[model samples]
Target: MTSSFHFRPMVLMASSLALLAGCTSSPRTPAPVEDRTTMGRSSTPTATPAAEAPKPLPGSENAGKPGYYTVQRGDTLTRIGLDNGQGWRDLARWNNLTNPDLIEVGQVLRVSPPGGAVETSGVVVRPIASSGPSSSVTTQDNAGNKEPTKESASKPNANANAQAMQFIWPSQGKLISKFDANNKGIEIAGKKGDPVLAAESGKVAYVGESLRGYGKLILIKHNGYLTAYGHNDKFSVKEDQLVTKGQKIAEMGNTDADAYKLKFEIRDTAGKALNPVTLLPQR
Candidate 1:
C-alpha cells in the first residue's frame, strides 16, 4: 500500500512540470532596431549650426566713410563753409553743386582731411622765388618735407617745399595803412568793388565781420603768421581755406570809410601784431 501511494504523488509532480515547460518565454530579436538615419540628425549642439555675425549694409552711417554736412535754413555754401572752418568752393565741388549759390536747404555735403583749414603745428616763413611768380609756387619740397622760405627762395632745383607751415599774403592792393606799434599792419586801398588778390598762398583763418571799428573782416593763417583783412565790401574767400598766390580773396571796399580801403594786419598765432610794411615790397 505505501509503495503504490508514493508512485501516484511522483507521477502528479511530473505532469505539473510538463505544463510549466509549455509556458516558458520564447527567444526574441529585439524588435529589429529601427534605422534612425532616415529620421535625420540628432539636433544637438554637436549637430546644430552656429550663428554668424551680421555684416554692415552699403551706405550705412559707419561704413568707414567720411563725415557729411546737411543744409539748414538761411544756409549758403559759402556761409556754412566759413562757419565750419572749410572753404566755400570746396564745399560746392565736393557736393557737385552746379552753382555755389544754388545750395539748398537739407542738402548733404562731404568733407575731406584737407577741406579748407590750416590744421598744422609748425609755421614756415618762405622766400620769394627769383625765377618769377609762375615758377615760384613750387608744390614740391626739397627733402620731401620743406625748405625754409629763405632757403627755397634761394635754391632753384634743391627740392620741393612740402613744409606744412608757410606764410602767404592776405590781399593784393596798395598797402595804404602801414604797420605801426600803435597800429597793427598796413592798409590796402581799393575801389568799392575791386577784387583783392591774395598777398601770398595760405589758408583762411577767419571770415565775417566782428569788430568795433571794422565792418567786415577775414583772417588767414600763413607760415607762422596770421593775416587780417578788414573793411571789405564782400569776401570771396571763407575761413579755414587753403588759398594760392595771386588768387582773388575778396572784393575790396570801404566798410568803415567813406571810400574803399582795407585795414590790414599781420599777427603771429600768439596774437602779436606784426608790421606788414617790413614784410611787403616797396612799390
Candidate 2:
C-alpha cells in the first residue's frame, strides 16, 4: 500500500509540470488591428496665387510719337490746340470734325499739319523785324539829295523777335503760391470780382470750365506760347476774340480754390508748364 501511494504522488506532480510547460510553449493570439480609416488625413499645403498686374491706360500704344497725340479722357479741342500751338479752328479743319466737342478717348489725332504743310489761304505772312532800336537808312537821290529809304529799313531776326515777348501781371494782388510740379502755376490773392487781366496779347483759345480743377478757365494762345487763367467768377471776353495785354478777361473768385484768387500759368506748345514769375514783370 505504501509503494502504491508514492507512485501516485509522483505521477500527479509530473502531470502538473507537463501542463505548465504546454501553457508556456503555446503562441499568444495577435492584438486586434487598429482602424486607421477614421483618422484625419495628412497632406502637403497648397501654394497661394499671385496678384495680377494693372492694366494700361487707353491709347497708351500711340504714346511718345511726334506730331501725333493720343486723345485721353477729359481732353477738349481747345485744350489740345493750346497744347499743340495750333488754333482750334485749324484743328477743326485738319481733323474734319463737324463737332469740335466730340472726341473719343484712345483716338489718335494729328497734332501737326499733315506732311508738314500748313494752309496759308487768306492768311498774311509778315516778316519779323529785329528787336534793336530803329534807325533811318539814308540813300543818295539823283539830284545829290540824301533821302531815307522806305523799302529796307528793318531786318528780320526770328530769335530776337521770339525773345521780345513780354508779359504783365494778371492781377494786382499778393502772391499766395509759386509755380511747382504739383501747382503748375502761381496763385494771386484778390477780392471777389477783381479784374483778371491778360498777361500777354493773344487770341482766346478756350473760355470754359471743361477742365477739372480749373473752374471758369480761360486759355489764351500767344503765338507758340499759351497762358491760362483759372478760378474766375465772370468772363469778360469770348473765345476766338483778340485780347490785349493788361486787358480784363475775367473776374477773380473762389471757383475751385480755397480763397478768392487768380491762378495764372504759362506753357509751351508741348504742354510743358513754365514759371509765371519768370515771365511776368517784377512786383
Candidate 3:
C-alpha cells in the first residue's frame, strides 16, 4: 500500500530496554558477549557449571563485601573467580595483572575503588601473635616493646608471613632494596613473568595501570591493612578476589625495568606505609 511512519514503536522499545536495565541487579563487570547459537542452533555456555553454586560476586549478597580473603590450599585465580562471582578476564583486569590461571596459598588480595588497587606478593591470612614484650629491650619501642632488630626482622618466617602477614613475595627473588620511609617500598629483581607471591590474605580491593614508577601494578587490602606491587610483567588475581599465603599473585620483571625489578609497598589500617624490613625474612 502506502509507506507509513512508525516512530512511536521504536521509541517504546528503547524506553523498555532502559527500564529493564534500571530494574535488574547488575554484575561487577559486564561485557559484550557474542551469541553464536542462533534460533536453530544451541550451545552450552562456557561458564562454570550451574549445579555448583558460583562464588559470590563483589558487593553482591552472595559475594562477601570488600574484606579479607583467606587463601586456602589448592586455590587458583580461576577458582577464586568462580568462587567470588568473577571471571578470569575481569579478575586480571581488576588487579592490573597479566595471568589468571596461577595463584597459590597464604596470599592476600585487596579490592579497592576504581582506578587503583594493591596486590601482595605471597599473602597471609592470620594475624600476628603480639608476643608480649620481647625479652631483649633495645633502642626504640612502640609501647615498651623491645626494638625489633634488623637481623630478626630480615627473616620474618615464611610461615609467619602467611600466618601473620597474609601475603608473600611477588616472585622468588632477593630483596635488592629495603622499604625506606623516605622512598616508601622495597625493590626486588627477578625473571619476566616470574610468579610473584602474595604477602597477606585479603580481598582484592583494586588493581590499576597508573603506577608511576611501577610498570604494571597490583594492590590488595587486608583487615585494616593494604599492600601494593608494581612494575610487574602481569597480574594474577582480580578485585574482590580471595587469596592465601604464598599465592602467586603476579609475575616479576619490570615492564619498564632494565633489570626486571619489583617495587613492593605495605600500608597499615591508618594508610601509613610501613618498612617491610621490620617483618620480612632474611634473604
Q: Poorest 10 consecutive residues of model 3 by lDDT?
A: 56-65
> Global lDDT of each model?
0.61, 0.78, 0.61
Local lDDT at 172 for model 3: 65
Q: Per-residue lDDT for 1-283 in model 3, tens only?
A: 2333477778899999998887775655778787665645656546676697766533243233354354577765543543343333445666555655444454454333244333343334455665555544356666776664542333345444334653445556778887664777788777777788777666666565543466776766665456777887777887768877678888776575568888887766434577776656655
TM-score of candidate 2 to 2 decimals: 0.64
Alpha-carbon TM-score of each model against the true structure: 0.43, 0.64, 0.44
Give the range where candidate 2 is weakest over 10 consecutive residues by summed lDDT.
Answer: 118-127
Worst 10 residues of 1 by lDDT: 158-167
RMSD of 3: 26.1
Clashing pairs in 2: none
Using lDDT, give the best candidate's number.
2
